[model samples]
Target: MASIDMDAFAADWIAAWNSHDLNRIIAHYGSDIVFLSPIAEKLMGNGKVAGLDRLRRYWTAGLASQTDLKFELLHVLRGHECLTILYRNHKQQIVAETLEFDGDGKIQRAFACYQLEQG
Candidate 1:
């Protein structure tokens, strides 16, 4: 497998999130991808979503809910076929996502965690 430029990918990924363009953001994932996030349960009625269609629905709802959504990338850790990204959301939530890529360099599976601030 060809090495992916983590920096470049991170830049584009951040741009896509900041753009709030679902198509652009989803372009990084594979059709059969599986995504797991805590927010997914609230948005999609489940903590895990599979396939592009479901992912689209979940992401659409998320974007609609957050009108001022923006991702501030903090760090990136690269693996053989995966990348872990640390970022801050518009709501001041710190998020970490691990993405596992397919042979085609598309994200096949992703897991997200968030650090919620205590009041």
Candidate 2:
């Protein structure tokens, strides 16, 4: 098996997200991908999202609430076939989200911590 290049994968992941193409975004993940978000009222898995149909809804709903979605990659940790990312988001508010990816260059897990800033 080929070793996973966390840096390149992480970069591509961020690019895909910035593209805002849900289909292209999902195409990067494995079948059993898991998504966790502070905004998502419910945690989600691939089973919950059989295909792009539900993924679109999830993406739309998750991003619609935020005005500006700017992300800066702070760090990258590489595991056997996983990547852990530390990033900060600058939107109408400032927030941080941790993104983790599995073997297939897909997001297996995520943690989003967000708080509104006043200034």
Candidate 3:
């Protein structure tokens, strides 16, 4: 398998999110991927979403809720088999997502953290 470039991946990831294209964003993950995010709980009543089907539902709901969503990439940290992406949302919240890649270079597991800014 070929090596994955974290910087390039980060760029594409941000673009995919900013585009609000669920299919484009989901394409980065494996079919059996597990994603953990607080937003998932708020949207799907669960903090952890497993499998592509559930992930698609969760993301579709998110895209619908945040129609003008955009992600501004701040940093990209690369590890042996993981990548940490730091970005600012349209709401100006700082979000960080750490993704672990499968053997095929698809994201197998992902965790997201963010704190919304106070008005």
Name the candidate that leads on lDDT. Answer: 1
Each model's Cα RMSD? 1.1, 4.5, 1.5
Of the candidates shown, which would achieve the greatest TM-score relative to the real structure? 1
lDDT of 2 by residue, 1-119 (tens): 14556677677767767666666777765555555554554545432443345556777765665446556776776555455665666654445445555655466555556665676
After aligning candidate 2 to the native by TM-score, how far in Å is the CA of 40 from where it should be?
Answer: 0.6
lDDT (10s digit) by residue, model 3, range 1-119: 24888899999999999888788999999999999999888877889999999899888877888888989999998777998999999888999999999999999999999977687
For each candidate, the alpha-carbon lDDT, in order, equals 0.91, 0.59, 0.90
Pairwise TM-score winner, candidates 1 and 3: 1
Q: What is the TM-score of candidate 2?
A: 0.64
Q: Pairing residues by index, what is the TM-score of model 3?
A: 0.94
Give the CA lDDT, 0 to 100, for residue 105 in model 2. Answer: 47
